[model samples]
Target: MISLLLVVGVLVAMFVAFNIGGSTTGPAFGPAVGAGAISKPVAAGLMGVFFFLGAWTLGRNVVTKLGSELVVDTGVFTLTTSITVLFFIGVALLVGNVFGVPASTSMTAVGAIAGLGLAGGVLDFAVMGEIVVWWVVSPIVGFWVSLIVGRYVYDRLDELVAMERSEGPLFTVDRSGSVPVPRVHRTTNRRELAGTATVVGIGCLMAFSSGTSNIANAVAPLVGSGNLAMNPAIALGGLAVTVGAFTIARRTLETMGSDITELPLTAAIVVAAVSSTLVVFLSALGIPASFVIIATMSVVGLGWGRATRRVPAPAVVTGDGESDDPLREGTDTDATEVPNPSALFDPLTTARIVLMQNVVPVVATVGAYLTFRYVPIFGF
Candidate 1:
């Protein structure tokens, strides 16, 4: 019976870990993938490696916090608590999957723990308070940081393009004969700023942060029961999670990246940077925060900022009798050209997508909880 219980617990942990990978890989790799900076398979491969590294190196702190520190003076963590927490996380992941919302593993895990603690007379308000504070602050900070950086960086790039265009191409056009001839500049400066290098760096950082923040989801329960040492647990858990993410994370990524926000390269990179930073910080502080929520919110905020900037005003005639509305007489004569590609997917659709992302986890959690709760044959 003891062996059976341990097996069951480990299985549950694996399931939770798989869900974490599915939900997290999108945020880690979506920007790079959407930007065409890397292929999906390559991103997945890189994510698997960095995720393992992050989990092994930084995930330990989050696992300790979840497994041992949330509740106070509890001699033995009941199987009931572990099962309950697992059920909640599973439910949350299911919800995210169904609605296309990238549910935070950290949020669901903490919520489950809090719920069980409340039921078991082990609720720690102070700890809960701190977690709540960070939850609110992390996303907000990410949003503003992303907004500032995205606007500034993109604006600079636009200025450079404008300047280059104004320079008359450094060539001469001749129409002296029946055929028009154009002369091209033999010498041109090639700016080699290593943009790809920066992208690779960000990708690495995002992958590492994802692995570290997600370890708690898969290994915390085992670690909590003192059945597995941290190092070995992380190694095994990281491997399993990486494989699961690479295999099944695409569905969640589509829901978050395509359905929620039509992320351009700039927005995607900013979101990735901010989300990765927030998750790494939380992991260091021994807080289990949701990477999905953090990343999702960051993307949404960036999109929203861009959208507001693009709100259309009433069309007016200029002094030269030309329309300022690009849609009317733009160089590209496509009538359906959307100013903000992100606006193509609105909040309503995004909400629905996010709803799908979250629904699967909720159902799974509820089912697991009920299975453990009502099945007397198992002798829970």
Candidate 2:
């Protein structure tokens, strides 16, 4: 019976990991893919590799926090209870995927476990409080940093990073030596190659951040239950994430790369760097960072700042013996310089994305609480 229960728990854990992969890959690699710096398959491959590296390292800290520290007693994480918690996380993330929005895997996972802890009467208020504080703080930090970058540095960076994809393959094999070495295509300019590399490198960074924060979301329950050791469970979860990266992640890639917002290449890079750094720092402190929320807020901030760029405040408006009507007094060129409010993303679409991300976690938290509180089979 124990063996069968363990198997069931592992399967459920993998289901959660799979959804994590699909939901995270978009935010990690969307900019690179959208910029034609790399193809979707290459992006997926990089995501799998970097994600594992992160999970095997700093990710352990986060796993320990979520699996054992959030609840007063790890004993509450029986195999049945673990499976139930994972089911709520997996289903909630899948709903986000269906709507083409990347959900917060960390938030959903934490919510489920928090619910279980509360229902089982073993909730750790201090740990939960700390996590909640970081969750609130990180997104605000990401937004402000991104906003400053957009307002002061975006235009210059965009011009410097402009990349035009050449007509053919980016690289070709040169078999002149004993080993076949890859060489950049002659048609690709040095600047273009450098820009592409930078974009791809940032994508890898985002993937690593995702792994650090998200790995625990998949396997923490089982790890806390003592049904599976940490290393083996992390490896299994990484494998499931890899599978998801190669498959269902494709749809999410499309949504993020193009549909999420009109994110310029420079803006995307800025957001990725800011959000990824925040997640990694929080994960190192044993907190489950809300990557989706941080990234989305970063996007909005970047756009808002860019749209509000300070053009010449119009000589007429300065009340210098000029006409009172600023619009009529300014040159036609000045009149055409008016900033459009919707320069970066559609308000309605952004609202929908934000709403769904928050709703999924809430649903998971509420559902887990009700199940553990009312269902005798969970042994809560």
Candidate 3:
């Protein structure tokens, strides 16, 4: 029976780790893949390597905090509670995948632990309050920062692209007296901004941060059991989880990058940079926060702000080539042609995505809480 229970616990841990990989990979790789900055296979390879580094190096701190420091006794983490938490989080992630939404690993993991703690009569109200406060604040902060930066950067690029388009291509002549070849005048402003340097830098930082920040999710439960030391377990778990995420996260990345927004390379870069930095900062402080929530909110807010300023209303063309819609007669059609708001910033989709992401954490947390409250009544 003891051996059977150990197998069950290991299986549960593996399931949770797989889900973490799927959910976490999107934030690390979505921008590069979606923006055509890197080929899919290359992105996957880099993601695997950097994610391991992140998890192995910085993941230990987060693991320690979530596993042991937040609660009173690790002994309370029985196989039953571990299985229950695993089930709740697994179900939540499956639901999100079904609906084509990206759920958050950090949120689900922390919520489950908190719920279990509450049910076990180990509720740390003060610590819970701090976690909640950060959860609420991080995304808002990320959104505003992204919004401002995205606008400035995108506008400048737009102006530069316009300039390049207006001035025709340059020409060069060969010494052999052959026909003059058209020299490609690369737009330094827009094109250079999204070049290799920028992409590589962002990719490295995001992968590192992802690995570092997500250590808490996979190893927290094990860490909670006082029989184990926190650092080694966290390092091993982080490496394993990062590998899993790099392999399986592609599906989730497709959901976030294409389904949520038609992210241009520059905009995606900005969002990743800002969101990853925020998550990393929180992780360094040993605070449990949601990278999915942060990245999604930042991307949506940036897209929304850009859409409002640039997206024009629909119009009907008249016989004489005039617009029949009075409201849109003189509006800018160049910006409106792409259907930016409708394609990328649909309210229903945004709400659904947010709901799916939050549900896993919420349900898992609540279930753990209830179990903790009622387990004694069953005479366990």
Candidate 4:
């Protein structure tokens, strides 16, 4: 019966990992697909590979932290408790996919683990406090950094990355010699090729970052229960993510790809790079990072910065390019101009989105805490 329960727990963990794959693949490869740089299969394949790399390397530290340090008593994570915790995570994922709202799996998992600790009478306040603090801090930092970028250098950067794909396939295989080599098409210019490559490369980077942060969500509870070792758990979790990427990520890919294509390629790259880097940094320090929150904040910062810019009008001249006051009633042609209000960002919409983003984690946290405290389903 013990072995059977452990097997069931691993299956539940895999179910959570499957959901992670489906949700994360879209954000990682959306820009690449939007730019027509790569196909869904390629994106899915790269998502699996880089995610595995991230899990195999930086993701382990987070597993250890979550499985060992969050609770004061590491022994609290019995097989039954682990399964109960994973059940909560799997429910959160289901809610996210079914409702079209993207939430932080890390946040949900941490919340469950914390709840389990709290109920067991051996919770570690210090580790829990630190994780919560970073959860608030990361999103704010992302917003401010992106805001500065949007305000000062957005247009210039936009021009710098003004990319348009030319006609025909980017490369063709030639079997003229003993080996085949890829030959670039004549119509595909250098800039277009470079832009495509950059977009696809950034997608891979996002995949790596997601893998680093998300692997712990799936396997940490089981590892805590001593039902599985670290590497095998990671391997199972990574494989589950891959399964999700290939099978369930198609619809999200279309949706996110379309939305991202409406923006400038550079903007997409900037947002992805900034958000993914933050997640990776947090994951390296044994923290479960929230990818959705950071990405949303970064996007909001970019748009808000660009929209509220004040443009300076040049001076008016009669016959030559001379300094003439246009503010004067006689020569108000091009002098100091009134700044137009670029109130493009909708406050209500942003507020609602942000609010909605918090809902899954909040529910997961409060629900897990309450369930663990009152319910006897897990024998805790």
Each prediction's RMSD over C-alphas, in Å, is: 10.6, 4.1, 8.3, 3.7
The TM-score obtained by model 4 is 0.90
* lDDT at position 125, candidate 2: 96
Residue pairs in candidate 4 whose N, alpha carbon or C atoms collide under 3 angstroms: 326-331, 326-332
lDDT of each: 0.65, 0.85, 0.67, 0.82
| Better by lDDT, candidate 4 or 2 | 2
Candidates, ranked, lDDT: 2, 4, 3, 1
Q: Estimate, for each residue in 8-104, the C-alpha lDDT of model 2 and write its tens digit.
A: 8998889888877776787788878777778899989999999999999989999999999999999999988999888888787678768877778
Off by over 4 Å in 1: 34-36, 74-76, 157-193, 250-261, 308-345, 350-380
lDDT of 1 by residue, 199-283 (tens): 5567778879977777887777678767667887787777767777778877645544433234555555666778888889988
lDDT of 3 by residue, 34-150 (tens): 554456666667766776677676666677777776667666676666666667767777876677676787788788888877766676777778888999999999888876665
For candidate 1, the lDDT comes to 0.65
Poorly placed runs, candidate 4 (over 4 Å): 257-262, 314-343
Better of 1 and 2 by lDDT: 2
Expressed as tens digits, the lDDT of each residue in 1-380 for candidate 4 is: 44888889999999989988988888889888766778888889999999999999999988988999998788878887888889888888788666656767888899888878877777789998999899899999998888888877877877766677788888888999999999998889888888778888888889999889999999998898788999999999999999999988877788773223335678788888889899999989999898888877888787777766645565558687666755444643433324334524557756765776678777877787888888877555
| Candidate topping lDDT | 2
